[model samples]
Structure formats: structure tokens, C-alpha cells
Target: MLEIKNLHVELEEEDKKILKGVDLTVEPGKVHAIMGPNGSGKSTLSYVLSGRAGYEVTQGSAVMDGVDLLELEPEERAAAGLFLAFQYPVEIPGVGNMTFLRTAVNAQRKARGQDEMSAAEFLKVIRERAKSLKIDAEMLKRPVNVGFSGGEKKRNEILQMAMLEPRMCILDETDSGLDVDAMKLVADGVNALRDDGRGFLVITHYQRLLDHIKPDVVHIMADGRIVKSGGPELALEVEHNGYSDILSEVA
Candidate 1:
């Protein structure tokens, strides 16, 4: 459902390029894991696809079911069913998590020409969704990510993803800073959302995360390009051999 072709990106203020002709396709109902060392532009691909500022797409296209994402504004991209779960979710002081979520959900609904969800309906749905992510009501009452731990922040991101129910999900370094148990909980939360209508691009550094969230396709990115792609075995190979062999062969 999501296709990225020859995507070249660079910082808005500098000549340094982060992604160089990166090509990828995430089919519906498939989980694609991108494993790479630091500086490979995995996160940049996510940000660019989600329409974050400070970077310019110098070439190529990112299309979701024929919609060119590069031409749309960030909110417009969201309305088009693209979601990015940040590696480090930001904190917004004085804004309750519930309030922020309700606003965002309703805004997305309104943008799509759907009726806004009432407060009672919203509360009921959020509570049920939050419970699965192990989020307590007290945590929801607090300002967004203000005093949350790293795991809590990740869970909150997943909760937001669940509530939004995007068609294509991009998770950047979701396993970073997560303990084993926290990782499993987050993985379970992600797995529960799996279905025939959605696609997932999971960006992670190691294979442990893959153990919990099995990917149908695995890709190795190097020097801002996707160098290799295979089935789940590729992740196991990376876990055992690192990127040296694959990088050299592709080089």
C-alpha cells in the first residue's frame, strides 16, 4: 500500500544528503523491518514520508496507494492514513494526554468528513485502548509525556497509533531504550492491531524486537540506501553476522 522510489533527501540548510535513491514497498497486511546501523537514514525516511520539516526531498516520490505524500502537508498526510511513531515521543506541558488525543482524533475525523466522536464515546474507546497498552487512567490525566519514563513514552506512542488507526504505520527505533518486558508489551500492542488492511514499516537496530513482531520482509540499509532485502532469515543473519558480509557483497 506504500511505495517509496528513489527517495533522495537532504537537510534544508545544508548540502549533506541523508537518503540516496532509497527504494522500498510496504504491501498491505505485511510487516517490513528495516535493520541498519546508525546514520543509514532509516529515521530520515520515516520523517520525510510523514512530512516533517527541516528536510527537503531532492528527488523521487513516496506514494501511499497512489497519493503522493511529498505534496501534502503534515496534517494532510495524517488524513491520508500515514502515521509515524517517534523514537522519542515529545512532551507537551499543561496539555492532558486525553485532551490532546481527543482533539487529534476528532480533528482527523472532521478532516475526513466524519462526525466528531462525543466525549462519552471517546472516553470509553480511549480507556479500552489504553488498558491494552497498560496505560492507567492517572497517566492519561497527566500532561502528555511530561513525567513518563522511556517505556511509558513508547507505550503512549503505541496508544496514539492505536487510537488513530492509520493505514500505514512507520515505527522508528521503537525498541530503543525498552526493556525486555516493555518491548514485549509494546510488541503485543502492535501485534493486536495487525490485519489485512494496514501495513507496518518497523525500523529497529536489532533482531530481538523482530522476535516479538515478526516481519514478512527484512531490509538492510547502508550509506543511505537499501542494500539488501530478504525474508525473516535476513534478520537472523544480521543478528549473527552483523552487516559486514551483506554490506561487502552489496558494495
Candidate 2:
């Protein structure tokens, strides 16, 4: 349900090009994994799509189900069904997790012209979703990500995804700091939300996460663009051989 065509992006301050003509299409009901080296612009693509600041789209377009995503503000994009789980979730020191979630949920609902969830209804749903992510009540009462371990932060991100139920999910290195068990829990949470109406763009550095999520398409990105597209085996190939072989072949 997401389509990008010849997308080019550059850093606003430095004017250095990051994404050079990236063309990709993510169909509904499929998970697409993007595996790339450190500077391959995978995160840049996610940031631009999410409408983050300090980047300029020099050319091309990104649209979700025919709606131009590049035209919307970040919150507008989120309201339009875009959810990004960050590589490093930031700490909000004074904002309680449940309070933050409720505010965000209601804000999106209001943007979409929907009724706000009652406090009791919201409590029930967030609790249920948090339970699935192994988040305890004490954790929910804490300020968002404040003093949370890496695994807990990541799990909280998944919890947010579950509650939002966005159509297009962009997980930028969600596996970055997770342990084996924590990774499995996060993956299970993602898989539970998989459906015919949803699509996932998983950006990761390694294949270990893919072993759990099992993407429908795997993309190898290099030098700011996608170099190869294949099935799940492509991730395994990267795991065994590294990016050297593919980079050379594509070069």
C-alpha cells in the first residue's frame, strides 16, 4: 500500500545527498525487510517518509494507497496510518507512559474525525496490548522510556504499534538493542498485528530479526539505493556472506 518512485533526499544543513533515487513498493499484507550497511540511507528513507525535519526531498514522491505521504506533516502522516518504531527510543522524563499513549491515541482519533476512547476503555485496551508485549502495570505508570532498559524501550515501541494499529508500519532497526528473548517478544507482538490490511517495512542491520518476522520480500540496499530484491533467502545470504558479494555484483 506504499509506493515510492525515484525518491531523492539530502540533508538540509549539509546539502549532502543521502537517498539517491530510491524506488520501492510495499504491498498490503506483506512485510518488506531492508538490510543495508551503515550509510546506505535506509533510515533516511524512513525519516523522510515519516516527515521528520532537517531533510529535503529533492525529487520524486512517496504515497500511501495513493495519498501523497510527502505532503503531510509528521502527525498528519501518523493520523494517515504511518507508524515508525525508532532505532533508539527517546526518554520523556515526566510524561507517564499511559498518559502519553492516551494523548497520542486520542489526538490521532480526533484528527481522523473519530470519537475519543473513554478513559476506562483506553485503560482496558492499553493494558491488554501492554500485556501482550509483556509490559507490566508499573512500567506503564512510569514516565515514557525513562530509566527503561533497552529491551523494555523496544517492547514499549511495539506496544505503541499495537495500540495505534497503523496500516503501514516502519520499524527502523527495531532489533538494534534487543536480546534474544526480548527480540522474540517484540517479533511476536508484530506478527500478532499482521493482517491483509497492513504492511510492514522492517529496516535492520542483521538477519537475526528476520528469522522471527519472516519477510515476504528482502531488499539489499547500498550507496543510497536498493541493489537487490529477493525472498527470505536473501537475508540468509547476507548473514552468511555479508554485503561484500552483493555489493560487488551490483557494482
TM-score of each: 0.99, 0.99
lDDT of 1 by residue, 101-197 (tens): 9999999999999999999999999999999999999999999999999999999999999999999999999999999999999999999999999
Q: Which residue pairs show backbone clashes in model 2?
A: none
Error of 1 at 89 (Å): 0.4
Query: Candidate 1, 131: how far from true, in Å?
Result: 0.6
* C-alpha RMSD for every candidate: 0.6, 0.6
At residue 190, give the lDDT of candidate 2.
96
Scored against the true structure, residue 90 in model 1 reaches a CA lDDT of 97
Instruction: Count backbone overlaps in model 2.
Output: 0
Q: Please provide, for model 2 over 192-245, each residue's C-alpha lDDT reduced to its tens digit, 9 standing for 90 to 100.
A: 999999999999999999999999999999988999999999999999999999
Single out the weakest 10-residue window by summed lDDT for candidate 2: 125-134
